[model samples]
Target: MALQSLQITALTAMRARDVSRPSREQQEAADRRPLRDETPRRDQPHRGRDR
Candidate 1:
């Protein structure tokens, strides 16, 4: 049927998108890259007296 064919086409397109999505390795590689706009900030120690 025409409707069935249309559904199959839509499903195939969706599957293609899912397959092209980045894998865990690609995501890790991207995360390791530094962003151009910011620098890492150091955490400051507490100044108040504490035993």
Candidate 2:
């Protein structure tokens, strides 16, 4: 019974990981793209100030 419960727990953990994995990948992609996009836009004013 303990072994069975352990197996069930493992399966549930795997399912949860699988569900979250895609959203994690999407967040990583958004972070990469938006970081670059936002940096330039934010830097524009700073650059202007320096000039």
Candidate 3:
């Protein structure tokens, strides 16, 4: 049926997305730079509330 086909298509798309996600190491490396940048701000006395 059309609905069944649509469901299968959605499942395939979801699987594809899962497969395309970055590996754990790649994700951690990406996160490291931003965290490093924030560290200095966190250490500062005037990390304003507007952030």
Please give the range of 10 consecutive residues that has the lowest summed lDDT in model 1: 42-51
TM-score of each: 0.44, 0.37, 0.42
RMSD of each: 10.7, 9.1, 6.7
**Model 1: per-residue Cα lDDT over 1-51, one tens digit each:** 776665557889999999999999999998998886666866876677553
The lDDT, on a scale of 0 to 1, for candidate 3 is: 0.77
**TM-score order of candidates, best first?**
1, 3, 2
TM-score winner between candidates 1 and 2: 1
Give the 10-residue window scoring lowest on summed lDDT in candidate 3.
36-45
The per-model lDDT (C-alpha) reads 0.82, 0.70, 0.77
Clashes of each: 0, 0, 0
| Best by the lDDT measure | 1
Q: What would the TM-score be for candidate 3 when compared with the true structure? A: 0.42
**Model 3 ranges with Cα > 4 A deviation:** 1-8, 34-51
Ranking by lDDT: 1, 3, 2
